[model samples]
Target: MTTSIAQPSQTKQPQHVDPAKKRPKVLIAGGGLGGLSLGMLLQQTDIPYEIFERATEPKALGSAIALSAATDALFKQCNIYDEFVSLGKKTLSLQVIANEQRRVDYKMDFSAQQQVLGAIGHVIARPALHDLLFRQIPKNRMHMGKKILSTDDQGDNGITVTFSDGTTASGDILIGADGAYSAVRQNLFKRLKAHNKLPAADDVPLPYSTVCLVGQTRPLDPAVFPHLLQDDCQFINTLGENKPWAQGTVCWSIIRFVEESKTSTDDKNGHSIVDQEWGPEAAEAMCNEVRHFPVVSGNEVNPLTLGDLIDYTPKDLISKVKLEEIVFETWFGGRTVLMGDARPLNPAGGVGCQNAMHDAIILANWINALPSDPTSKDIENAFRSYQDERLPWIQTASNSTRFYRTMASGGIVAGLLRFCAKHMPAWAKRKMLVVLGGNRPQCSFLPLVEDKGSVPPAFQPSLLATKPKTPATSV
Candidate 1:
């Protein structure tokens, strides 16, 4: 409850050692948000680490992401909160509409919630967030186009990671921050199975009943899209009538402000737009689905349709993908461990990315807490502690996301929740917000640079964020 971070020990300065001789080198798989964030944290702590990514280039190839109050706290600790706030658009309220009638059915105002929690939720393009994290990491430490083929635990010496390009690297520990289809996780499970130590139901794919299509629209004209400019409400969700589970459609659209200045196409950081590829068939199919669906707003005379939004979006940015859930039973073995999507979790609650960031912080904390020249057993123990501290919260967040995804998927429970959410009294809604928004974990090593204000005692430091210098070149 409101636990303040313990300052670094004044008497014992962290011993600097030759990285090649004494320091334990951390090998990170994947270069997504979690991996990159972890690299930044390790840099801040002077922890030796290397990041390997299969992708040939650093490209943020997704739509928008919602950063909650908890995530906002992490950003502030990392000294990038101001950058994020400036680049992203804050969402004040959520409006749910009936697809058939083209009218607003429910609205969840977040103004009160923001005031209570002291952190406002913002919606920003995925690429923008990626660029922010990527810039913080040094060029030499990040290795792109290196696909990991397998990993071998070399007992006390270290772990050997073999890449697809016939190269090998040894590190004290291996972390799987790769996304859903993680090669590191696959290898870990395989090794466990070989040793007959695999847990029950450990590597099953997450069940997904919903298919989502997401894209960002080009800068909107305030004259043509006045409702989109309103800070009062930034996001809108449209749900079909209740149907059998996983059989109905739910569409979510947000007008993201990719840039603050209309005249400037280039971001304030001077990065030009990176092109992405979404096949023609996929784009056509997504546009076909919502071509006629009304884009309803509060009492607007005429609203745009899904097709109009897609038309405004760059063809390359649109994407269609199924949403799935997975929670791994085992997170670590020997010198290798899992984090972010590799751990058991789903992407529904809009908290997946935030949780991924949390994983980096917690794991880094445990790792950084070890001695400068830690033994193999010491590293293993730190990993065990990392899983112990994080597994329960990860499970809770996964369940919450599952519940929300089910409710949004159009079913009996979905109808019930919608009814309750629509008719719930203001006080009841506030109470619900308090319950959902409480107990968020902040970074432990970083001091709270900007307090949003007093939050509930439930808000405490369970994770830590870090800063990095120099940009890394692609391998």
Candidate 2:
């Protein structure tokens, strides 16, 4: 099914009101996935909000994003789960291939688990998902190229934000969906440190020893990579042990058919395609590193090399980055809060995007629960509640990613894990898969976003409770 991106229709702006008389206005910085998802939720709830992106226009710049059941639940709450599923390939199994011979060390089949858990993972191109979210947002509410310079909490008046262009916008609450190096976080911490409230280690970068290169090949021919095209497979990972030549576990995540091919006039979605070209320098460097890396298919007589995958990939789509892990100790202060990569996590498990979307859903739910004319204290309580509910899960996710990275890196523990995964009884493996797939945080609000209750407790704000009917006031 081809999903068409509808052009945003222009609508008259709401009349400007005095800052003192306006209801709580949400000022979201960084219009990436988290910000846009939050904006969509706010729009659904009829809450006043705006999203700001530093870029001139929406450009899907990253590689593929894997959506877990937790994230799928958020999509369902927004009534877009089916549309979202239609845009990506269902990921049913994961194969961990090892060494130059392309031997399969461990495999996880998710088909049966999907049946048991009621949700299966999907791997989609980042741009397609971004475009899907972008189309639903109101044009006037999404401000492009507006880089947020700094934010000020104006006590009873709310928060004031200044952008790179010297203009100013004020809102009752501010959200720092702005990624890792967030200006909102920086400013908030500066003030907190001045007041002796900031933690000493909160400002440093998380340590990282792994480098990752991600890219997509054109529509893959089954004959070339049959394993990737199989009904029960979506991604293949080649894991290597530590060597003198390469430090840590060197791993490659090879994803296929993440997005459908684009036509000259439109994307799989009927919207006009925005051309994003990749340069050769990065691709050349990546190809040099993994030229001899091997990948195997059950049907093929011989294994394929990483160089072969690169050869088929368009040069412009390749991206390289160092994999780092950082989970902030604090997520909010006063009326300003952080979401998504701004909160930080290890990328090993490919759950960063899912977690970010989860943050948006939970935060939006809390904000929507606030009174019609919430006080600064009311907003602060909501921020605290949002952080308190999400921090433990975020930390768990970070630790899981770090642990996976360690297991992928050849070590005594990695060997043990691989052996267990390979030799475990079928019943035990299915039980483990059921546990892994079943235990995920879910959204708890309207439309009864139901999934397997085997997961952890999600923040379920009292939907039936009415907001306080206080006089309209600023932050």
Candidate 3:
């Protein structure tokens, strides 16, 4: 991990927000799941926040994501789980496939993703979850088109964020919930370089192959997803002839139908979701290249959304998951701390959103835990506690997941996937799931279930099962 200082902008220093206010003003950048979730969580608390989103509208980029049971606790706490129920499909089975052979069809959640094994979660469409969170958020709190151009943490008492449009807002604190390509994190990198505290150059290209496509479709003919709902998560892996394979090796894994466009009004006009929402034609292009499997997640959902329209015109661009750094050099420095993809930035292990949400959960709790009339030391203590409590597992999950993805995706390069898929016994797959999904060495911080496995006073599997994957440190 290498962190370098970019020249700081010749901008004015940040003005301070009144720290004595009962609800500290917080500025959140980026409006993805992390930003929205953070905002929703804070709303329940006394913390008032201003969420800044560069995009003019809310768009679901990428595809579906499986929220682990642990992360779902935070959602439930925010009181939006029921809203998600209407938008998401309840997955309940785990089935593994290699060519035509069914390797393991265990009862589990996230069964659709072969990479996951133990921790049961809901593999939901990004749009659905986004809508749920957006709906729950107080409409007045959102500033849709404001793009943050620069941020300055005064270090005295607050941070000030300036938008590209020349408007400025000051907050008692700034939470960098921005995505992987984060501007706030970039500013922190520059600040760290100014203070001379970043890591040295050690980043190199990681060789792996995982070209994924994101679209939506209905569940299988007899409702195959219901079977996965039976357990925690369901994962189906297809070990290709020349693809990668290992106990935890995951080369060809699919996320199934987890993303959707709630309204076509955005697309019909110029307004849209994320820049990545693909219509039918672009999805077809991806299928034409990625090789169409037996109605993988996207293929099925595309038809449902684009009915009677045989072909979709091109707009959204779909691409492979090719990257170099799984972890960034410095996530936070001084008064500015990075969270979400801007934090760990792991490509695999389904940790990105997890890490981001955990950032919110731990940070919000820490601040709220502080004395009502808190001091700078109180703020600093909260910051330190957030890092100390969350950093260890995040570090471990980042290294572990990166290593896991490297090995699984490297099966082709190292001549492992094909050999193991053909020779490895069925029992090996089950054991792999235990390690990959349950009791993962890197992410002990994330318990299989949240709340230390404490059953609520009203113990209901459906209520308990509605949880999504908890905060992933790797994200």
> Scored by CA lDDT, what does every candidate get?
0.67, 0.66, 0.50
Model 2 C-alpha lDDT per residue in residues 1-475, reported as the tens digit of each score: 0123544422323323335444578999988888888887777654689888888978645667777655776677666777787777677766766665566656666666555566778877777788878776888799998887777898877899999999888989999988765678878887787788888877454454555566666666566666554443246666654421111011234321111222223333222232332235654655676667665644456556666766776766666554445777878888899999877665667778888887887787688777668888998898888887777778778777767655565668877876776777878866755544443544333455556534333434433233333488899
What residue pairs clash in candidate 2, if any at all? Answer: 4-270, 278-316
Candidates' RMSD to native: 11.0, 9.3, 12.8
Q: Which candidate tops lDDT?
A: 1
lDDT-better candidate, 2 vs 3: 2
User: Candidate 3, residues 90-171: lDDT per residue as tens digits?
Assistant: 4454344444233442323334233333234565556556766676567678888887778787775677889999999887
TM-score of 2: 0.81
Order of candidate numbers by lDDT, starting with the best: 1, 2, 3
Best by TM-score: 1
The deviation in Å at residue 172 for candidate 2 is: 1.3
Give stretches of model 3 more than 4 Å off.
Answer: 1-21, 90-93, 100-120, 201-211, 217-235, 241-287, 291-325, 372-377, 403-407, 410-475
TM-score for each prediction? 0.82, 0.81, 0.65
Off by over 4 Å in 1: 1-21, 241-280, 297-302, 449-454, 457-475
